[model samples]
Structure formats: C-alpha cells, structure tokens
Target: MTEERPVRWLDEAEMAAWRSYVVATLRLRQRLHRELTDRHDVSLTDYEVLVCLEMQDAYRMRMSELAVLMGSTKSRLSHQVGRLEGAGLVRRGRDPEDKRGVITELTDEGLALLATAAPTHVEGVREHLIDLLSPQEQATIAAAFERVLEHLSEAES
Candidate 1:
C-alpha cells in the first residue's frame, strides 16, 4: 500500500489570491451572461458558438471542431446549433469531404445578429473587466491566463 502524504494546505495569502481569482472569474461570466440574455435574448453559450463559427474560414466549421472550439459537449452544442438554426442565424449541412460528418455555418442573419450583439457584449466586458485594469495589469492578467491555457492544452495532449 502507498503511504499517505501530508496535505499541503493553502496559506492565508494563497487562499486570498485563489479566492479573488475565483470570485472575479465567476462574476465576470455571470454578468456577461446576464447582460447578453437581457439585451439580446441570447445566452452566453449561444454567443460563444456564434463567435467560434464567425472566427472560422467561411464562417463555417465541422460540428466536431466547433464543439471543441466552444468547449461544449457534442449533444449540447448540437442542441444549441439547432436553436440557432431555427432562428435562421445558422445552418447545418453535409461536410463535403466526409459524408457522415456535419458542418455548421453562420447565416447572414447570424452575422447581423452578432453585429448588434457585439457592441453590448463589448460594453459589458469593458464595464466589468477592461476598464477596471491598467495596461500593465491587463497584460499581466492575459499572460497569466495564457500560462493556464498552455497547461490545460498540455494536459489534453
């Protein structure tokens, strides 16, 4: 049997830093989600899917690729795409190279909706985030998150 190692509990300073990051991250996402819902009748999840598609070539991506980009489960992303498709904001089609695969593309309606929603989203982000930080603080925060992302990507591989 393996011996039990002593726990390395967080000290007061570390706890404070961790708690601050947790609160800030949750509050940031909550505020953005609420504002998007109230102003655009769109959830943050839907907006993310749209943004992911928008960033792709031809504003289209394979369903599996889109799911990964959105960090959503296939079933959940499929349902979300269904809603967008129903709203005429997106469409699903056969992937030419792979008959069994699906493709998702932003429609003109989706682009137009994003155009209207982008301003509100940006304002929310600024009000809650960017405006609160100096340039150096912003850069530090970005670099820190980049490190976190790199770690996560490494874990995935």
Candidate 2:
C-alpha cells in the first residue's frame, strides 16, 4: 500500500490564472465555431478533420491515426466522419496495406470546402487568440503548452 499525499490546493493567483485560461479557451472555441458555422456551414470539428486529411501527403490517413491526432475516441471520430462522408466531404476506404484498417480520404469536394473555410478559420484564430497576444507572450504560451503537451503525452505512453 502507498501513503496518501495531501492535496496541494491552488492559491488565489493560481486559481485566477486557471480560471482565466479555462474561460478564455472555452469562449474562443465558441466564437470560432460560430464564425465557421455561420459562414461556411461547417463545424469546427469537421474543419479540423478536413485540415488533418489535407495535411497528409496522399490527403488520407487511417481512421485510428486520425482519431489520435484529433484527440478523439474512435467511436466519436467514426460518427463525425460518417457525417462528413454523408456530405460528400470525405470517403471511407479499406487501407491497402491492412485489410482490417479503415482509411479516410478527402474528396475534391472536401478540399474545395476546406479551401473556402481556411480563411475564415485563420481569421477567427487570429482575431480571437493570436492577435490578442504580444510576440513575447505568444512565445511564452507556445513554450508552456509544448512542455505541458509533452509531459501529458509521456504520461499517456
């Protein structure tokens, strides 16, 4: 049996920082989502999925890998992809190298949609997040998040 450790409660400054981060991120996502949905008729998640597929050399990726990249569960990604597939933005196919593996390929329609939506997404990102920060502050945020991501990823593995 291991000994229990005392909880290290956050102090006022820490709590303030935590709350600010939480609220800012939540609102930023909502604002971005609204902008994309209104202008492009695409949800933020679908836009992200399209972007991920477009980034690949073949404009395709295994569903499982895409799920990992999206930080989503397989079932959730499957449902999301199903919606894209129904809309003709993406198609699901068997992986050539692995019969059991499912691959998602971006359709020409998907690429076109992404091309149209990219500007809106970029502008939203800039307006809501990037443009709000100074160069030094941006660098600090990048460094902090990179460290946090690395630590969390290592823990997962």
lDDT of 1 by residue, 1-157 (tens): 9999999999999999999999999989999999999999888888988899999899999999888777788999899899999999999999999999999999999999899999999999999999999999999999999999999889988
Q: State each model's CA lDDT, in order.
A: 0.93, 0.97
lDDT of 1: 0.93
Ten contiguous residues with the weakest lDDT in model 1:
65-74
TM-score of each: 0.92, 0.98
